[model samples]
Target: MQGPPITIRLLLLMLTSVALMTVDHRQNHLDTIRAGLSLVVYPLQYLVDLPSAIAHWASDNLSARTTLVEENQQLHARQLLLEVRLQKLYALEAENARLRELLNSASKVGEQVLIGELLAVDQDPFRRRVLINKGSDDGVFEGQPLLDAYGVLGQVVEVTPFTSSALLITDPSHAIPVQVNRNGLRAIALGTGEAERLEIPHIPNNADIQVGDLLITSGLGRRFPPGYPVATITEFEKDPSQPYARVVAEPAAHLERSREVLLVSRTAEEPSP
Candidate 1:
């Protein structure tokens, strides 16, 4: 049970370690033994490191997936914004085309004209009227004629500081003096509360009017300028039993579709015959 004292045992162990280190350093005696020990412990070292390696791999994968998700969301939002902008561009292109057509009509009118955008349309089915953006401040006066690209649209009936109301040619209370462009036969075109139809009353049964005749403003009333297209006769019926012939014509202007119109000045002189 008894052994050497503690100081003597510690000195002996230190001497042994020094001797082994000297032999390993100078004679390379421990290289074979060190290789054998490393071979035996390599699997144990790998096992000990496996959990930390797996944790690092999992963390990298999760971070990559989160980054991809965020990038995808950003791209989707960008795509939606681009689509909205493209739609607006298309609308603007259509508006520009319409404005060009208005300019062409203005050139043919040979009158001082102001472009007016439609602000509102009357909701009443029987009343074909629309509100325009220009008014007295813009020289838009009552009885001022309105025209679209194709033909006469209407006349301004009410005016305010910044807006005006116009009665379309198809309104029931509206009437315009139109004559047959083919034969100079005079007739009155009266609105019948229909969007496309105008009734030409008081045409004699023996009148020279026929179907497919073009009707133009006769400049008789002085309300509208001369030689402006108004309507085309679609139906002409002669009834011997009736005193007047039944005539129906379609409006030339796209009253229900025009979004922009021209407010024509009243000073346009009549065309020379």
Candidate 2:
């Protein structure tokens, strides 16, 4: 016998809930159970609210203009540090390249060269000369050829016991015999009394010279080392009426800014002991 109808089941469920509630209230039997359940849920409630606390702290930190300024200053300092290191690397690379060229020049000349340090540049506007820290005491003599890492610069003209003066190839009174590196057409390169320019005064209008010819020492005067660079032709002009071409060149040496030079004692340029 299926004992109860649907309505009867529902009526019985209501009466049992009411009787349980009345008993719990009279005896306080459920109080410990409710407290135990509250304790278990407290940690979850705190966890759900943690996001708001973190957001409030971050907002306060970002609101201050002073904090942004401090961060920008730190970034600038780091950038400057890197730039300074880059400059040092550039200097080291230039120095290494200059040393390599000096070694090559020394090998090609096949002479004993004494290193000369610049003491002072000549102040006279009419002369292109410099004083070096080598003299008779260092075996330096007049007409001794001076060169830098690049090429022939000048010859020592006056010497003291401890110092000497070199007249640059750009001096008005200086001249060197040179030949075209490509064809060996000989000419005399005369200084223009300027620090940057030289001239070949008597070049034939139809000479084998070109605008970009290299002029190395021709060993004609024997004052400069043969095969050493003297200048580079930059311009060649010929007038129909004139018999010669006006050839101008730039000095191969760093005439305006050399800090060091080599004093080569070739057989013909050196003074006898």
Candidate 3:
């Protein structure tokens, strides 16, 4: 055959040179030259890749509807599973709440009571107050005693048109007349702004109080019903030379955690005097 045309021969020589350069660069023998050439060709390489990128983007855009449908189905299935679990949880919670109410009702032998839900907790860190869903409209009055499944929570402090506020016994401003269940030693349990503890002040060092003793409302002030639990002695410090012992008690009621409460009405003979 006749010798290849001059232009074709030159193009073949250029291609051969490019291949040799590529091999040398891969072997790290022509790194500097290859890096310079790459920099020079970078814009051209990007321009060449633009067509393939556009094609990929168009393909994905065209298939978006199908992809979205598949993703939506997956999400709906997950939502259904979550909703079923939520239903079971709600049922369990309701059943537990109803059982607690039954227990409280059985314990209050002669008192009239109305069940109320805790609406909100006090925002002030200093005052221990809880808002209940009941108010004057529901026969809820100020000073009505609030109780949970275990013991006294507090008493109604303020009654609004549709809601009532309860001042917890753990409020610093509140104090309940209490007695040691074991020895029947009477003392006032004063709130110290602590959520779960109370202070029994002026208890004589010789008093028979001890750790683990149960403190119950003595009903001396007639504010709280008699025999209702208030706190349990958790710490007792008796100094032989001191006149008074230091006693710390933990509240027996779930005052800070309970979601429901019972508003017990005063007995007919026990009306406010």
- Candidate 3's residue-wise lDDT over 45-93, tens digit each? 9999999999999999879978999999999999999999999999889
Higher-TM-score candidate among 2 and 3? 3
Note the clash tally of each candidate.
0, 0, 0
Count: clashes, candidate 1: 0
Candidate 2, residues 54-159, lDDT tens digits: the string is: 8987888777667888889999999999999999999888867776777777777788888887899988888889999999999998999999988889999999
Least well predicted 10-residue stretch by lDDT in candidate 1: 264-273
The whole-model C-alpha lDDT of candidate 2 against the native structure comes to 0.88
Estimated TM-score for each candidate: 0.76, 0.65, 0.69
**What are the clashing pairs of model 2?**
none
True lDDT of residue 199, candidate 2: 89
Best by TM-score: 1
Which structure is stronger by lDDT: 1 or 3?
Answer: 1
